[model samples]
Target chain A: MAAKQNQENLPVVLVYRRPQFNLPHRNRLSRHFILLDPADSQEPTSSFLSTYAQSVRALLCVGYSTITSETLSLLPSLELIVACSAGVDHIDLQECHRRGIAITNASVAFAEDVADLAVGLLIDVLRKISGADRFVRGGLWPVMGDYPLGSKLGGKRVGIVGFGSIGSEVAKRLVAFGCSIAYNSRRRKPSVPFPYHANVRGLAADSDILILCCALTEETHHMINEGVMTSLGKEGVIINVGRGSLIDEKELVQFLVQGKIGGAGLDVFENEPDVPKELFSLDNVVLSPHRAVFTPESLEALIDLTSANLKAFFSNKPLKSLVEIEL
Target chain B: MAAKQNQENLPVVLVYRRPQFNLPHRNRLSRHFILLDPADSQEPTSSFLSTYAQSVRALLCVGYSTITSETLSLLPSLELIVACSAGVDHIDLQECHRRGIAITNASVAFAEDVADLAVGLLIDVLRKISGADRFVRGGLWPVMGDYPLGSKLGGKRVGIVGFGSIGSEVAKRLVAFGCSIAYNSRRRKPSVPFPYHANVRGLAADSDILILCCALTEETHHMINEGVMTSLGKEGVIINVGRGSLIDEKELVQFLVQGKIGGAGLDVFENEPDVPKELFSLDNVVLSPHRAVFTPESLEALIDLTSANLKAFFSNKPLKSLVEIEL
Candidate 1:
């Protein structure tokens, strides 16, 4: 009866998730907010949202569910969006900006995991860890003499695309391995010690390895294209832990096939789960199923962060990891 | 004529390498020393050594060529043995100790590369980087909904078996990843900040991961046996960048096959060019053909260090990485 009374006084927050996606930490979240999930209703999603979530002040966006302007129209009272993903490409940022709806993301939760994967991929590519494992599994080591020597990570110049939390974490880890860090971001960060380039092409030209960890914004889409690859040169390696659309996939395939680029460790693709068949045969490439930020620890952290953001917003306290509105 | 005079004036150094093994940085070393290689002679190794290398004061032991008492007997005037490998197990240290011959190894040259590999293997195992790549390459990602999430490296308790150069380097890199480090060396290092364990079992019991980076000696061989693995428990991971003999291979295979231990990332196996066939099919273990210290950069460093050590010995200067013989 006490719990029910407490729940009755809690703020109403609509849970915006796909039908297949389950809201993590549902039990923990239910204590502070009355979560209005359309998936749990007998009525259609549109009817369910129009009936109960019309007056919802906060919406928690789960996974990559598209948050269109039309969806925003349904929740007229929605003042805040707490995203469970680090990247906000699916969320209609412009629409939210127009309505003055504050946004917070799971960047702090996902940054370290993404950064860990990025460094892992870089080391895997440079040292041929995956390739060597494949060779050993294939029983080719005795038949074939020595596995070809891999490049050392120490003293390599690494250029990071997107000097955000994830990119900064990667730079921090790689610095310990003696890599020189440089970055290209939307704007130069004045206090950062790493040298910054205004453009991806300029960064690629100066780097032995290029790690992509940026957002999939319209201006940044296909940012690592043919020209960037050409500048990166044949000996350069690419590690993409960011959104798939960050690189022109077709151009990357061509470059990799032609040996125009040395190697790649890709977690994301332009079309995920449908990787280029050509890449499957390349020993120089490591393909992951877009799981850079999906560790159990990070997922748990995401849940806590999502709930915390929503709680902070309700209490009129400062939000953690808020997305800066350009407008 | 001047070049010829310079070559003749250079100190004679006997190069003892396997017949199939070509010395790296040969050109660089040749400029500084009169390299007497038996592999270049039509005469047998013993005969060649007796004829030309009898008075050779310095011997460069390359590529794990055994420097036994018989081999050392060939060079009675041998003052110093400069090893091209980090581990001196291949060299007869006892014989060198009895003869009062100083020894230097490429530990300083190989430390960074070996450490890089140790960390690489740890990340590969923990994050399933190689396994995920295999899944994507085998076209299993789309068929399988999602690859299983790997454990996060952050907050993992990593216990290093050695506190030498390579082990220390591994600790340094892992610290940046937020892994708390402890170590078990032959003796506790007074200078190192990480907590020390007197035995492998103690370290294993406290650690989530055990990394083997110590030299393979009679006392240290098979140190990470059943007891250590048992202490490590079912979820523990072992990353070996040290010699294969540091682990009991049969026990490891059994533990892995039975799920008694979590996973492993093995670079050196008990037998080179021949890994256990059972391990070939296991997804939990990553196998590399003992090439951890063979990076092109490290190999280059090895050659430079070998030349430096030999030059230092002949010039009466202190050696860069002299092995302190246990008297």
Candidate 2:
């Protein structure tokens, strides 16, 4: 077929394992790029990458697939790392910086959905949506008469932990809900109107709610701890849509159990796929597995942006979503 | 005995039966007016109302107590019915109109919280916040790997069914989250920016989401029927923050079961304290126990508003929250 011939002529792209979803647009990616999978080759993964992907100029990293320095070395001809995920912590940024390999993340494509989730979580925690859902599902409504009242989101002093693309989007949404917004970031965002706190503890001290949307880095690891939780006080809520390590997970669970803080709506956990079982029964907390970026609209947008970035790379045009590696 | 003596000097006010929860504000209401309750007297309920509430000029209606013609007949001197609730469905609007009695609902005090819940429910259903929270809590994440992707709220064509105070508030909040808004009101709102559809069926046909915030009048009852749900199609979500009867509950359950519609986030059911057991197991539908107006903030605001309205009534000035019972 002419299409098969065209596929053979297209540039080889080493696509990491497919995302575990029914991605309708992912199938269309082949029309633009000849996607090759190491898992599909008869040979083992490392050898397959060395043989077939050695001359591959671009690699499309899907989900949280690790791209190590050793793996980068294998793809000596690789010019670009197109991440199909918002967070690039799994990819070795330092190695890419050393090699001068270009990195394009899915931030622009996924920012709205992630921000949507962050606001959703904040509302859920404050309104007890998940808890109320559980109570209704348990057939307790008829007997219980009325579900417990939840706190209002309006006029709450909200502190955004990262005022990045995702955090900023969250502030935009919550502002319409009448929440007063503030933030704590690596640097004060001059373009933003919110008061910037340099420290998470200070942010918590001033905020009735804290929404975490920063990147996971060594310096920012375990940024939300017992002291910060205590500072947030008995009525403060924390909504984390960023990586799990952004908070002290054990301490958060302990604080939630001990009632040091109001509640939480957690999309990610420190030991993911292994959430603390203690949270299972808590009416105040809403626990969701790390799924902030998991939306059909976001995923489709990711496919489009990633394909454009690859097309731009092959054509030597300005790349889309290129992240300046702060090495 | 000074407090008891002060109560004798205060103006008489007939307080309706208490809500299920402890009313911390009810104790303080005595500081403004001499509170009268049928339950407080040793006489029977009807006898107490006839004896103690006969001369009461202002009555504080709490919870869903029915102000029947008979009950109103007992308080012939009653001039104002200050409801501590937004919906006056339980109150005899026709009877009050015929008797030329004034009524004031908690629309102003509870609009923000109800709107907050509507937006929260929309986000929860579209993003599967409640379902994902359930998946994580059930310890199924490790086994399930990832929850199914939910639709994005951004850019979705949201058709608001009723465009009153709560609907306007919901639209204001959702616009910031990137939802394209439309509405179906009894009459076109000249002040609104969104497109206006004359009928709900047409609105549903054009919308990815439908948010019901209209009052439950005789004509407005069961507004969301099978035709509307079918027009919304397989990807459309319905969010009800208004009274339960606004939707045909039986048809909604059938549609969800057949996958004819996308999902629903129900804050109020057709029957109070009773939801369809069929909806209990559906993953797409998010069930809430009629608590959209039950936030602590709204409750406090209601207390303040009710107190103010009662104060205004006794002083013979214009009342706050005066419902102009459209006769």
Candidate 3:
């Protein structure tokens, strides 16, 4: 009876998420707050939000569900959005800014796992780990003599796109493998030691490997296009752990099929779960099903971070992982 | 011609290797010395060595050809043996010691590439890079939903077997990934910061990952056996970039099949080019056909080091990568 009374007295938090994004692990969120989830109710999301979330000051957005201006208008009392992902591109930054709403993302929680996968993908491409495994599994080793030699990872110049938390971690790990690092971002970070390129093409031209670790936004969509691939040259490799739309998929396919680009390790495709069928036959490419940031450790960290952010907002304390909304 | 005369005047260095091991890159060694290859002659190896290599003071042993006492007896004038591979197990070290012959190996050249592959294989197993690639290639992503989440690389307890050049290099790379390292070797390296286990089983008991980087010797053969595997627990991963015989392959396969051991990343096997068929279907294991140390860059470095060692031996200078013979 005491526990039920305490739960009823807890601060209310509106949970906004798509049906597919509903995870069982998220039930932990209800321990500290009264979560008002429309999915749990019979009414439509808009009607449910209009009924119970009218007085809700905080909203937790799950996965990549887009929060448009129309959705924002429904939650008139929402002062903060706690994003359960590293990227906030799906959220209406302009509308949120107009409504004087604050935003926080899971970059701090996802950075290490994302960076680890980026390095793993880069190594897999350069060393042909996946290709060699296929050769051995196909029982070709006894007949084919030795598998072809892979390129050395040491002494390669790696150019990272985005000098964000994940990009910085990738640089740190690759440096230990004897790779020199450079990066391209919206702006040059003062404290980072790696040389910065103002554009992706310049970074590609100077790098033996180009890794994408940035957010997907209007200016950054399709940033890795034909010109960038050409600049990366025939010997360069690309590793993408960011959003699929960051690269122009059609041009990338042509470049890969034509052998214009050396290889690719793609975790994100322009249209995921629908990767280019052409890439299926290529041994030089390693295709992952957009799982770089989905490690159990990182997911557990994300849950803790999301709960902390909500608690901070309700307790009149400073929020964590706040994104600087560009005007 | 002046060049022809200079080549004729160069000191003799006998090249002993199987026909398959005759690499084109080794022709570079001919510039500095007269390479008297027994395989180049129609005469039997013993007859050829006795005839043309009577005055040869240095012998270059290529690949993993067994240099027995009988072969050593044929080369009466051989004062030094230059091994073109990392492990000198195939060379008659006891016979070489008895004859007061010095030894050199390509460990210095192969260490970085071997270390790179070891880390690549570890990442492949943990992140399921190869498994995920297969899933994406088989067009299963769209139908199967999300691929299963992989364990994080960071915070893993890694135990390195052998603290030699390759082992040290592996440690350097894994440290950047936030893995805690411990090591077991013939002798504890005083300068290494990682805790040393006096035995393999103890190391396995504490580590989430055990990497084999030691040489194959009488005492070290089948070092990773049933006892060590059990101590490693069901969640422990094994990575062998050292040699195949270092592990009991039959036991390893059984453990993997029964889920008594977690996973494995094998570059070397108990038998070359012929891996156990049972491992082919296992997703947790990453297989490479004994090509971990065969990167183009590493091969180039080996050629340079081999030539340098031969030149140093002829000129009475200290040889590079000299193997310390245990008396």
Ranking by DockQ: 3, 1, 2
Q: Give, for candidate 2 chain B, the lowest lDDT window spanning 10 residues.
A: B17-26
Candidate 1, residues A1-327, lDDT tens digits: the string is 997888889999999998867787799888788988888878998888788887899999998899999899888999999999988989999999999899898888999999999999988998899999999999899999799889999999999999989999999999999999999998999979999999999999999999999888888899999999999999999999998899999999999999999999999988778899999999999999998987888778898899889989999999988997663
Q: Pick the candidate with the highest TM-score.
A: 1
Candidate 2 ranges with C-alpha deviation above 4 Å? A1-12, A18-27, B1-10, B18-24
Docking class of 3: high
What's the C-alpha lDDT at position A276 in model 2? 94
lDDT of 3 by residue, B186-272 (tens): 888889999999999999999999999999988889999999999999989999999999999999999999999999999999988
lDDT of 2 at B53: 71
Candidate 2 lDDT for residue A205: 97
For each of the candidates, what fraction of the native contacts does it recover? 0.87, 0.95, 0.92
Give TM-scores for every candidate, taking all chains together and pairing residue i with residue i: 0.98, 0.94, 0.97
Q: Which ten residues in a row have the lowest lDDT in candidate 2 chain A?
A: A17-26
| iRMSD per prediction, in order | 0.9, 1.0, 0.9
Q: Cα deviation of A55 in candidate 1 (Å)?
A: 0.6
Q: Please give, for residues A18-101, the per-residue lDDT of candidate 2 as tens digits.
A: 435232475789887788886666787788887788788899888788889989999888899998888888989998988889
DockQ of 3: 0.87
